[model samples]
Target chain A: MPQPSTRNRLLEHAEAVFRQKGFDGASVQDITRAADVPKGSFYNHFDSKQDLAVEIVHRYAGGTDLSPLGEGDSPVARLRAYLLGELERTEITGVEFGCLLGTFASDSATAGDRVREAVGEALASRSASLARTIEEGQATGAITARRPAGVLATFLVDALEGAILRAKTAVGPSTAAEEIDIALDALRP
Target chain B: MPQPSTRNRLLEHAEAVFRQKGFDGASVQDITRAADVPKGSFYNHFDSKQDLAVEIVHRYAGGTDLSPLGEGDSPVARLRAYLLGELERTEITGVEFGCLLGTFASDSATAGDRVREAVGEALASRSASLARTIEEGQATGAITARRPAGVLATFLVDALEGAILRAKTAVGPSTAAEEIDIALDALRP
Candidate 1:
């Protein structure tokens, strides 16, 4: 097996620490130590901690496995599948760490402009995906809606993130799944 | 006019700084400086910084000035009204601070159990209020739903909070309000 590239290794380590302690809470030393990389190597790999954080968020936003949402039979079914996937992720992580972007966004001090832009683009993309699914569902009569497709799509994404935040706060991943079902129920005919 | 009590003054200042800087990010000196109180006076008002933070959240959670969702309205309308009130608050503060309790709950690592419990109770209460409004809306037929009243209500609260977080990150308070309208729109018939 090919050894993980140093850049990839640095990003993986940064993500872990960033998730554990947030952008402001985590230090460069902590990140380098966690990555088991020398300080000089960390600088060589990334320009600054803030830059590394931006990249970490970009990587996560870039690589979310949204393929399952694409394969479902209907819009609502696809949305439910996506929510279930998030719920399963919570189960694996034990609800301590939530969406990395969300974790950083909640901290006003670390509200970096680039981080914000990346999140907005990612969310906008997700909203567009959901809108497409809703439109498909409407065209096929698999779903019924009186409002604009974009509105419903954005609502679903907003609710999912909020539900996850509450679940993480309550220390219960199951709550997030259940909340998603509530939104899903609304989408059913 | 009667002067505000010292304890109340501390709570106000702490809430502002805490919302902007988070638990670990805000320091005692910052709190005292903002309040214009002497360093020694801070301890005189509260047990510690953690104690003061708990009080601040408790105070904010209970201090919403908007009227409650009244009787006779459909639960959906009432729910919409309540959410609108919260959105209005975002505008009032320019969304500069977002939700204090949410900011706290999302970043309470340095805070003790008291602070966590205070925020949790507030969130739970907020969820319960929204759920009750949904139940009322279901009875009136002005709004329709597919899930149990409690679940829909919790989902609504979760979604709104997520929207606020997104708005804060995106630096567009209006986006948060718009996103909230999307979720509240779901309850309409």
Candidate 2:
């Protein structure tokens, strides 16, 4: 196996490359070049580009900081903070690629069934986490009672994904922020 | 130059292939094979893959049927018809590939600046059309005044895109329809 740092660097830089280029658009050569690693080193670490993509999905989801969802005083407040934190992460990373999960979702149709499953599960996991807070908000009367908390959580995540796609084309925060706020606002009583 | 029928087949089959495989995932060879045209004949019809993609975007957007948005009795009812019509279309077409416009939006990052602009304009035009209906809804008190008509229209489009992304993974209309309905419901006064 390659050194630990080389493996880490491959994951980091390849994520950026994959984000910039869809699964088919980006090549191992592009990823290696981005990571500044020897082209031959790629196979030594990953079985294939698809294998690397799956790993990247796992690592990206596992690495998200979800503490913001629990930090604020009210449930609605926490929900807003968690979502805005997501927006903040996208801006800081590179809205040009949008959210890595979303990027994967967009490319999942042809990236392989495994990639499709990975993104689907990742999106569902995030939605579940948000649902917990939304449920609390509904109980506390901070959110509306018309829709199920779980349904509302999925709406927020779905809208956020769409907004991220816009940010990819807009290459900025304004449009995405506006779209996300609309979903968040919809949760209100 | 190739015959008109050959050119027409290329467009129809290329849209399907690209919708299924994405811009980066689909190649001239793949498109030609699907269209049953010679690979070399591609260059005779278009300058490059990018040029073909630009034309595809224009054609896809131009081909959408927006009559459903205008046929219903009330503004809100018309909006619902339009959205449900979209759902019906996704079912009739391949939901596994989602909307062609959205597929391009997702792939636009690496596809090229021209493709990106093509998708951006397509999405904006659609959003603008939706906004006119929303404005009418607001005037008739079918939609809330809390947000501008344009803002609500953009939100609906963004949310719909996200739902379509989910359809790509689920390979069905159930989840996408539910997600889309939530956004439509949010527009209620």
Against the true chain A, what TM-score does chain A of candidate 2 give? 0.91
Q: Which one wins on lDDT?
A: 2
Residues A31-111 of candidate 1 have per-residue lDDT tens digits of 888888776788887778778888887787776678767894667888888768866765565465566766777764555
For model 2, what is the alpha-carbon lDDT of residue A26?
89
Give one digit per residue, the lDDT tens place, for model 2 in A1-189. Answer: 756576778998888888878788889999999988999999999999999999998988998889988875888778778888888888888777788888788788889988888888888889899999988888989898888887788888888888778667663234766677677777768
Best-matching candidate per DockQ: 2
TM-score of each: 0.88, 0.94
**Model 1, B1-189: lDDT tens per residue?**
998776767777787788777776788999988988787888887888888887788788888753557655656556667887886776576464567766776764435667767777788888777776677777867666566666667777788888877777654334565666566655656
Off by over 4 Å in 2: A1-4, A171-173, B1-4, B171-173
Predicted complex 1: CAPRI docking category? medium
Assess chain B of each prediction and give its TM-score: 0.86, 0.92
